[model samples]
Target: MYQKKLVGVFGDPVDDNPSVVIEQVAFDYMKLPMEYLTIQVKKGDLQAAIEGLRAMNFTGINITMPHKIDVLQYLDYVADDAKIMGAVNTIYVKDGKLYGENTDGKGFMRNLRNGNVPTKGKNVVLLGAGGVARAISVELANAGVKHITVVNVIKEEGERLVELLNSKTSVEATFVFWDHKYSVPDKTDIVVNATPIGFVNKEEKPNIVYESIHPQMVVCDVIPNNMNTLFLEEAKKIGCKTFHGMQMLVNQGAIAFELWTGLEAPVQVMLEALAKVYGD
Candidate 1:
């Protein structure tokens, strides 16, 4: 008899999470006797859920939403990069100790490469300065992007991210106050919306000057649930290349997949699984 291991993700509103499908499909394709679950962990209950993971011997987990930053405190040790990034999206159990790591930026880069999106020497503009934005901005800098512009409603948060990118990476980063209708610089090659604006409410979109976006720009949204957001819709109307959040989700899930099972994740199978879920 083969003993099955356990793995999953922790988030508050996990109803539409597709990572379980992505990982489970890969596990089945590889004939691995493991089970993947997406548990609904409410706000203020993260510590308890982490304790539960320890008690139940979960092989690993991916934390999302409001818990990513808070989960760091519960981990036994974290990767140095994660410490600098100030966030951890993946954790694996080793010798009953939980070790934290961040795969968000790397995963996003993989998504870009797999999608054939160009980033080298490209000026990028990020619409938010949260964990996802920070992760993507750092990787964009590492990829030798020419410059980065961080736009956020909060001055302090945006300034801190700009400072981090400028002082740490070799990328010239600047901050911009997100005016009611923020305009994308004409020279920007890549535009990313890494905010929660269209999250709980799919109908909502970020306040931006949609007309300012040029046709050659690559527009991206990290909102997993609403792949075709209003921003993307507007970008499409302008003949801009638009990218969905599912791509990032699949890539990031693949990273966690390998971390948890110590096997090369069947990315093709996971992509197909996601395609079916997304109905394409």
Candidate 2:
């Protein structure tokens, strides 16, 4: 029997996340003598928290929220993907060195490919200008997407994302100011909700008009819980294919688990864990 190893997620507001609960389910399913825990990290204490994680000898830590970008400066090394995305959502310490990686973009790609959603030469409309949006933009552009249009209530943020993408890849990317009252472009092949608009208790749901979404369009939301987000529901009503963020979460977690343990992640076990926590 293998001795139990420890792993977990760190962030404020984590107590309410289904991901934290699902970690427990993973432990039970694997029966590999592993334990998982969630830590509530206060603002401005990310470095200290990371140092404490090292001291505790945690196998790995999942970064979240404001800490993702902030923690980058503290890492000894970062993967190229995380560097390009400007964020880190997973960290692991090895040989007295802290390494960072951003699994969000690759995880999203995995979900997209696994679900058979086409991306090559497709026109994608991405909602929001935050870290998740940044990751998705880089990944899609690199995957040979024909065009990407980003929309955000904050014009400056949207423009900034477009500039970053243009500098990184030769893909045609543009930014547009979003007026919540209007419908999104009908020419879009994929619509992604990367903002928190559809999160639990978030006041405004995604503002895209459902009537404009065609049956051939693919709609995806980065919000995991409540799989039937208003954005997804509206898209579904229009006969559009839809995806929740749960697959992204699982794929990212699997990568992090592999980094921490150097063992192939039991993906089925992780999926079972998520199903137990969120219900299939």
Candidate 3:
């Protein structure tokens, strides 16, 4: 019998991330001799964790929050997409060389497309300027989003991402200050919350003006833990189409699975696994 391939995800406190169950479902469905695990490795020990993966001949490992950007320091090389996003969420080793890539953006796009949500020539208002926002913006630009308005509380990070998007992709990118008066543009086709506010704090209000959301618009929140986030709930109440955060997590995990195995991802199976875990 062939030995099992070893793969895992690493984060500061990875116990709660759904990638653990999602990837394991994929492996079992394919009947592949693979073991997927969740490892809790804080930022301080990132280098050691990565080194240990290399030493143990790990097939690949996924990097999560806090470590996504910092883990880049220990990689042998990073893909261009990951470089543009300024983070790495997937890493694979070959010939003793560690290669890093970011599939978060691609996964988001896949999820959107799979759900019949359109991106090409669409005006997107992306909330937050963090890692996930960076990935989403770049991928949207590459996928031919007509224009993008990025809103964030931090001026520096928002402007920095806009600059990167403008310089690297053909999409027209602009930064908007996120404040109390902020409202989703009426012409906007998609609104995305890449921030963590709604999930962590249930009482936290939705970032965009709930009244401004239209029936034609699609609202997405990248908070995986709570699928029916306040943002999505308000969007639904306002007749706007909504997407759950778990879809992003599953799609990204599927992309990582494919990257590691070089086989088509069992997307539906992964989705079922996510629904089972999240109870949606």
TM-scores of the candidates in the order shown: 0.84, 0.88, 0.90
1-280 per-residue lDDT for model 2 (tens digits)? 5556777777776556665655556556666666777777886788798888778777788888878888889989998768888889888889978999988888788889989988889999999999889998898988889999999999999999999888878679898898665576878899999998766563457776668888889998887655677788888888988988877778777777778777776777776667666643
Q: How far in Å is the alpha carbon of 117 misplaced in model 3? A: 2.8
Candidate 1 residue lDDT tens string, 136-177: 898899889999999999999999999999988889999998
Residue 249's lDDT within candidate 2 is 76
lDDT of each: 0.87, 0.81, 0.86
TM-score of decoy 2: 0.88
Clash count for each candidate, listed in order shown = 0, 0, 0
Tens digits of per-residue lDDT for model 3, 101-178: 998888889878888987889999998998889998988888889999999999999999999999988999999988
In candidate 2, clashing pairs total: 0
Cα RMSDs of all predictions?
Answer: 2.9, 2.6, 2.2
**What pairs collide in candidate 2?**
none
